[model samples]
Target: MTGGIQAQIERVRAELTSRPEGLQRHVGRVLTEALDLARAWDVDPDRVELATWGHDLFRAASPAELVTMARAAGVAVEAPDLAEPVLLHGPVAAAVLEARFAVSDDEVLAAVRDHTLGLSEMPMLAKVILLADKVEARKRQRAPVMKQIRRLARRDLDLALLCWADWKWVEERTHGWQSHAQHWHARAEWVRQHHGEVALPPRVPETADN
Candidate 1:
């Protein structure tokens, strides 16, 4: 597994000087980091690629269709559990791995399923995927998200998830955001499921004198 990963890295690096060089490198780094996280968490090394491979699939997705597309893939998605971190690709990948590749490897599915928000009962690989997405350099907007990721890296998953919920709130409030609040509502459900608070952080103060 390690050898295969190393080979993949080499291939990615070799293409770093090609078209969209920066993007290629960024993808390479994210892939490497995700694999590293998986290994550190004692995930099956062979299954680490699932996280590294598709961590950024949604990068180009229309934010509005992100969860919809994931849900459209066909799996028994629970109402609240159907949101967040699961929409993060944990279940989609799990289903893909099961139905397509017939891998039936628990660790791989676990890594994919929990890559986004987080699971209440996080498996090793799941945590790795979460951290990998949160810390990847391509996600370099150091405002709210970076702040929370750095703070939550060494802390509790539930706490980190709360911070992410705050980040989601900010996005919803951002100008020209074309997405809906389904994920927010969905996240609220997850927060309730996990016994956490469901409130978004206080809105960025509007100019009082405006």
Candidate 2:
């Protein structure tokens, strides 16, 4: 952890102070999980801390607020993003972190950007933050299966991500909710890679925000 990164972490953490209490607590738990995973993965804890603090900067915003923020941050608002503005929170936060907060680390910004709906290929830091967010203490309590995912993450982050995506797929199907195209594409790639497939079957075009 360089002095600059530690400074960035504090700045991001300070920004998180004004968010809702529940969100702050959630971020706290995520920090705990992320730092542990960072150590296990031999990643820098300062970078993990910065991303964890910044990931949910806009989580508690209303849909209209999210959309407004997204536009202000220059985040593209796709159909899914307009329909579910919460999806833009990650991108919005990432943009703000760079433009406003001077967080210049590409991997750190990528971790914050992709934490909500993971990308097909992520830096190790992104993987740690994404898995940590999903398997935080409250989330594990809400979904018992998160315990298994959390355990798996310690050994295999990619496998844990695939399992979490599978669970998310089932969840959306059960609830009659639409799967975001970006995540669906990412999940498809993970499935293909996991099975060592060279090509994927034809599917709906990825045309929405994650």
Candidate 3:
């Protein structure tokens, strides 16, 4: 890693200290998982660490605050983002990391920006950060299936992400919650890619064996 990148990492890590203690602990846990996955996937640990720390910088902010920050950061607040301003946290943090911290790595910025609602096309480092954020110790405790996803990520990051999206789909349906268009679109692409098909018909009645 270049000295400039190392300094950027340090600055972001220090910024994390001002966040809530719970959020800080969560970031630490994510760092542990991210670094481990980075080594396994041959991603740069420093970059992963930077993304992990910066991903949730505004997580504790209220929805109104997040909307304000997103607007100030020049992030487009779409209808979904207006409905659920918390979703703007990642984009806001990414903007701050770039404009404030001078972190110029596009991949790192994408990882932090898209960690909440993953994009269809992500670099390996983004995958590591996203998976690590989802499978951290507390998250695993909350959802036992995260343990399985974490294991699957070691072998197949793409498959693990597909599975996670599937689980989230079911979860949202069960709770009668609307799916964000961005995530729904990304999940659709992941499904098509996983099946190695294009523009496949919807599985109206899903079964164990399709």
TM-score of each: 0.52, 0.91, 0.91
**lDDT tens readout by residue for model 1, 1-210:** 233544543443343345354555665666666666554445565556645554443444343454665567775555444443335345554555455445455665666665655554656666666666666765756554665564565555555555666675677678644332444554676578556343655457689774
Give the whole-model CA lDDT for all candidates, comma-separated: 0.55, 0.93, 0.92
Error of 1 at 69 (Å): 9.0
lDDT of 3 by residue, 1-210 (tens): 346877988988899899999999999999999999998899988888889989999999999999999989999999989888989999999999999999889999999999988988889999999999999999999999999999999998999999999999999999999998888898998988988744577657878986
- Model 1, residue 195: distance off in Å is 6.8
> How many residue pairs of model 2 clash at the backbone?
0
* Candidate 2: tens digits of C-alpha lDDT, residues 56-168: 99999999999998888889999989988999989999999999889999999999999888999999999999999999999999999999999999998989999999999
Clashing pairs for model 1 are 85-117, 90-112, 90-113
Off by over 4 Å in 1: 1-26, 35-45, 56-94, 113-124, 141-148, 176-186, 189-210
The candidate, 1 or 2, that scores higher on TM-score is 2
Off by over 4 Å in 2: 1-3, 197-210
Candidate scoring better on lDDT of 1 and 3: 3
How many residue pairs collide in each prediction? 3, 0, 0
Pick by lDDT: 2 or 3, better one = 2
